[model samples]
Target: MKLLHTADWHIGRRLHGFDLTDEQGNAFEQIEAIAKKEQVDGIIIAGDLYDRRLPAESSVAMVNQMLQRLNLTDHFPVYAISGNHDSATRLATGTPWFKQTDLFLHTALSQAFKPVELADTQIFLCPYFEPFDAQQYFDDDSLQHLDQAFARVVDEMKKAFDPSKKHLLAAHFFAAGSSTTDSETNLTVGGLAAVPTDLLADFDYVALGHLHGKNALHMRQARYSGSPVKFSLSEAAQEKGVWIVDTDQTPVKLTFKTLTPIHDVKLLTDSFDHLIHSTDDPAIDHDDYFGITLTDTQPIPNVMARLREVFPKIVTLSRQDGFSTQVRYQGESGQQIRQKAPMTLLKDFYEQVAKEPLTPQQEKWAKTTLKQASEGGQPS
Candidate 1:
């Protein structure tokens, strides 16, 4: 059976407060086109279908529309699972009737045991689950970490494997030795969640998610399809795409098809004057998301405001010199610091201390707490 593998859609995700609705919609269009061109038997979305557990109403509507186009309108079976960012209860709401139209949405641990049988293949959809979820499912109190939970989970999946058909595992988790980018949330606590790659040796093919770069994991039988759109500055240079897996072959023939982003993420480094002047160049796409690093040793007055006038999509700004540190430590003025949004200040501090951006859950919690603090009330 041939299948188009993709993951980390992160619908409704924004790049530094810039809405990515158009970019995400464009990605779905490309994916649909690719699926049609390839004429695959089915499509596998490994995980992270949405950016947050509590997505906006518009995000929900958009996803519903996109899924309808893929599964109902175009008539392709879709096999998907919930990622860490997803709310399992919300995803499971309409799942009882989803398979009637060839839509298989797996969000719970119990759903993983029963493989979705297709032509010559049995696909085990393993959604992201906490150690406690696995512990409760198995009645094993010792399953305290992700590695331990996955060990038992895989063993049970193997028990239900059909010897006559190819076994494929569609899962969402961080694999041992896999690389990560700024866009991906760390699923580990001092390496507790990293599942050993060797544990997944039994599957004919392992389709993974959570990591945004397709090259994050390098294994003969496993691959990460990655996010179709860039979510962070660190992923500006990463090629975004999907994988076409031909499972009929002895060794699955995997082919990557690139998806064009509506507005590509770009990193521009030059002196402040040069960057401002380059905005007038017709060759430069001022609409594309940009992360700028100024080479000027001295700070420019109203630099961000000036850049915003020329490049309307500048997502991040810093300096190659120590200007960024100067702004953080010895701010231009206390008023300047006070003028920054609470969330922005929190994000800067979190990134500086943790060496990574806050996860969606963390950001949401921070926002809630900040709101409560501003209102002089405690969270209920």
Candidate 2:
């Protein structure tokens, strides 16, 4: 059986406070093209079909349009699940009605263990979950997490499975092998969620998600398809793509379907005078988005306008002049301190950010003011 594996659509997500619906639309167009080019027998999206529990009306329309385009007319069966960001009930509501078109949407745990069989392939879908869901599922009321929850779910699935057949698992969770960045939002709170690679031992192939960068989980038996679009600047060089799985009723082999988006994100740093007029450098792609930083002792005049001419998609520009920065020592509040004493803790905080010590007079003034605020008396 041949399948095109994709997930983490994250529809209606915002980047730098700008709506990404149009970019997302473009991504779907690429997906359709790939699906057509590959002529795969089926498509399986593991999870995270949307960015929010309650998506905007426009996002709903966008998802509907994309799904309709993929399965309705194309005649390929699409089996998907809901992730931590989705509204399970909302996503599963019209699922029965939509099943007529070869699109299988599974959001509830009751329906999760059921395998979707197609052409000698049995795919087990598991969505993202919190500690509570597992706690409720097992009725244990303890700190059940990713490892435990997945173990429980997969164990149940194993009980009813025909081990002789090729079993593929589709999931969304943070794998321990993957690296994280400052921009990544915590998928599971309290550090209770994380699954082991070995937990899915019985499955022939595991298509995974959640981490945005592509990775080889235990030599590609388990893997992350990665996000279709670059979510943060940290993921600047990610080769965003989907996975193509071909199962031979014994083992599955994966092929990374490469996707090249129109815009490339570049980070450039130079002195404003040289950079702004550096036409001699390789011609910048007018369509690429750039994050350029100007580093100079003196501020450059008309910097943004000049660079915008060269890089049409320059969204962010920063100046790294020394004076462009600020060093402020924050006290408790505006009325909290006037001056600090050598023995004062509040005064100690004031010295940290500024990297300077408070003078004697300032300390005395602060002590007097603090004393006055402490009592009903004025600064003495």
Candidate 3:
């Protein structure tokens, strides 16, 4: 049996406030093309269909269109699950009749016990769950941590595992030994979300989500397909794609298929002079999202405004020369620095960071904000 594994669509996701709707749509189209070219029996979306639990109306429409094309139109069976970012209740609304169309979306933890049996494999769809949910479901108060709850869940899944057929597990969790980037939200407090890989070793293959990079984990049986597009500047260098699993062999053969983003995430490091001058150069694709590191020793006035003129999609900016305003106040004692008026401090900090003094309007607004803060009132 051939299956394409992908996850973390984050359909409504944005790159530093710039909308990624077009980019995500492009990725879905590529995924459809790859599914057709590979002729896979099914497609597995591990988790995180949307970037937020309460997605916008437009996001819902986009996801609906994509799913309709992939499952209803293309005739490929889709096995999906909800992740930490999804509202399980909302996703579970029409799930009762979803399987009729070969769309299996598992939202609750209880839904995982029943495997979706296919030609040669039984896929257990395990959605993202908290320890409390598992504890209540199993009536075991001892299930205090995610790993503990996951152990019981895996044990329960093993009881129904048919030895005659290959078993596969599709889950959304931060598995142990997986590295994380800035884009992924922490699933639990105090690192309680990490599930041990040993518990997952029983399955023939484990398809995971939550981490945005496919290389986040190095286990032989488990893999993260990663996000379809770059969601954060930290993921600037990641090669986005989907994984293909062929279970016809003794051990499943895994192959990666690349999906090109509409606008790639990139990092450009150079002085302000070079970047501003390079705007006229044809070699640069200024449409791509960029993170810039300025090499100039001195702070430049209206730096972001100037850079945005050329790199309209600049997501982040930093100075590599370590320019600081602290040198001016090095001789002042901590008590002396603290004695300065709030407005004076604000003006100094703004001037140092922005490389320009505040305008009359900005100063007025800052004074009003300071007064409101001092009075324990919210700023208007």
* Highest lDDT scorer: 3
Model 1, 1-380: lDDT tens digits are: 88999999999899999989999999999999999999999999998898999999998999889888999999999999999988888878788898999899999999999999876899999999989999899999999988899999999999998899999999999998888787888564347788999989999999999899999899989999999999999999999999999999978889999999878999998888887888568777988899998897655668899999888999999877765555556744778868999999899777765568999999999999999999999986
Instruction: Write candidate 2's Cα lDDT for 1-380 as tens digits.
Output: 77888888899887666566766788778877888888888888878788889999988998888888888878888988888778988888789987787788888776768888665667887766776787777786654566777778888888767765788888887766566643446763334567777786678888887777666355457777877877667777678889888786345788888777667666777777777677667666655677777786444457678887777667578866553313332325545544445356655655653446778897788877877887888655
Clashing pairs in 3: none
Report the error of model 1 at residue 238, Å: 0.8
lDDT of 1 at 15: 91
Query: Could you tell me the lDDT of residue 120 within candidate 1?
Result: 88
> Which window of ten consecutive residues has the lowest lDDT sum in model 3?
321-330
TM-score per candidate, chains pooled: 0.84, 0.79, 0.86
Question: Relative to the true structure, how large is the alpha-carbon lDDT of every model?
Answer: 0.90, 0.74, 0.91
lDDT of 2 at 192: 53
lDDT of 2 at 14: 72
Instruction: Provide backbone clash counts, one per model.
Output: 0, 2, 0
lDDT of model 1 at position 198:
91
- As for TM-score, the candidate ahead, 1 or 2, is 1
Residue 55 lDDT (model 2)? 91
